[model samples]
Target: MVMQTDTVLQKMSEDDFMAVFTLGRKLGQGRFGTVFLSVEKSTGREYACKLIEKRKLVTCEDVRDLRREIQIMRHLNANPNVASIRDAYEDSKAVYIVMEFCSGGELFDGIKERGCYTEKEAAKLVRTIVAVVQGFHSLGVMHRDLKPENFLFLHHQEDSPLKIIDFGSSTFFLPGESFRDVVGSPYYVAPEVLQKHYGPEVDIWSAGVILYVLLSGVPPFWAKTEKEIYQEVLHGDLDFSSEPWPVISESAKDLMRRMLDKNPATRIATGEVLSHPWVRINGIAPDKLINS
Candidate 1:
């Protein structure tokens, strides 16, 4: 049944989600909800179900944000790199979003278990990530959070495709649109975001931070606390004089510098990032082991 709200169409079913799918195990939990491994009763297919409690949505803004998230996910349903929503069911007390289940685990975990990382591998991953950013920006959406944890491999295989899994902080945007809300993870958030005014460039900065961590195994801006992390993000220097960075190719460093530029005006655009020599498909990023 369709529940029409003022902001967006809530294509939510009033029936019980358990009637169609059986919840198996807890996958993860957040402020307002929990994700569970679920199995469809008819097909025996598995899925990740996000159950959001209506009671947790105490404020109107909270409800609006949840609706907006669903709308954005529906809007980006066609992108292969993003996790697709399978079905949405809402009852009196909660909303259940059934999504494509990713069993390969988080990107960083995959990287760590591999025991070896190279610039070529890093470039390939960054290419996919930047491509996702480019697709989102072209489609007028901005992913406020772009961190390593949000990317999960499709299966438990060496060659599994990476898929982005969160849209909680994402929103639609027009060209030159500036958002004032400071909404994002501290380590991956852009300096402009902390200042309360930002555009899609924030995504590039976050992706750049991820690339930095991928290469060096540490964040460019590190601090003991969230406040300190923000301070470092706003005022800290990009460290390339350290261990693995010394062996990393100059081209990769160049892309990082451009993407992490403090001035949003000078920050690399999504298209430019994909086209960069290091990030481009089969570009010049060396195959030498970065963590060696």
Candidate 2:
């Protein structure tokens, strides 16, 4: 049945937020939206549906991203590392994006519970992140918002791979386009991005931050506020003495340092990430993946 819209705004989505959206409970909620653990009423298959109020949408900059996200996710659905959007629709008050549901919580919870990755597990995670970044670049799309919270879990038969979720912050930066828009979690942001000159390399920077978090069990730097964090990011601060990280490989540390470099022009090359010292330890290709 087509949705009834007798008195909704043109861009206004479904006000029947409670009456229509189906599946499970509220999983994550942010300033402008909420994601629910939902199921396709017909197929009974599970999905993570993020519901965003159309009127509450912030930033004219967000409009393009909102539309682009739908387009990009459609094109990127087959990639193993990226989450698949099962379906999407707009209602009288909000837009409903039904995406693949990953039962395991964000990496943030995992880190809190497990402390940090064993070198082996951390390597596996980083490889997955690198592979995803490589895939996105190949498609000309950039996930400007990559962080531990956006990282998810999915069982690919044997075990789950770290899946990248929440593309609301992603954007399509055309060739030769140096993005000046300042967005993304303060801790995972690239120095160049914070400095207002970046390209796809910023994704690599965020990926490197994820690697740092997994291996070191904390962000490279910590501060009391967003401004302070950005300042630390601007300066590219890394704490060698941060506890629980002494055993982290020097090569891994080298990779983080290069990935987090203050200069975008001098940052590690895209193809070189998989070959970095951290990714090439013990003469193996760091998980040697040909991820499906």
| RMSD after CA superposition, every candidate | 2.6, 5.4
Per-residue alpha-carbon lDDT of candidate 2 for residues 7-64, written as tens digits (9 for 90 to 100): 2223544344345447589999866669889866556677888887767665654555
Q: For this target, which candidate reaches the highest lDDT against the unseen true structure? A: 1
Per residue, candidate 1 scores C-alpha lDDT tens digits across 1-292 of 2233422225547567889999999999877779999999999999999998776787777888888888889899999999999978887667888999999999999988888989999999999999999999999999999999999999989999999988999999999888999988989999999999899999999999999999888999999999999999999999989897777889999999998999999999988888888878889999887764
As for candidate 1, its clashing pairs are none
Give candidate 1 misplaced runs (Cα > 4 Å): 1-15
lDDT of prediction 1? 0.89
Model 2, stretches more than 4 Å misplaced? 1-21, 58-61, 111-116, 155-158, 280-292
Number of backbone collisions per candidate: 0, 9
- Model 2 RMSD vs true structure: 5.4
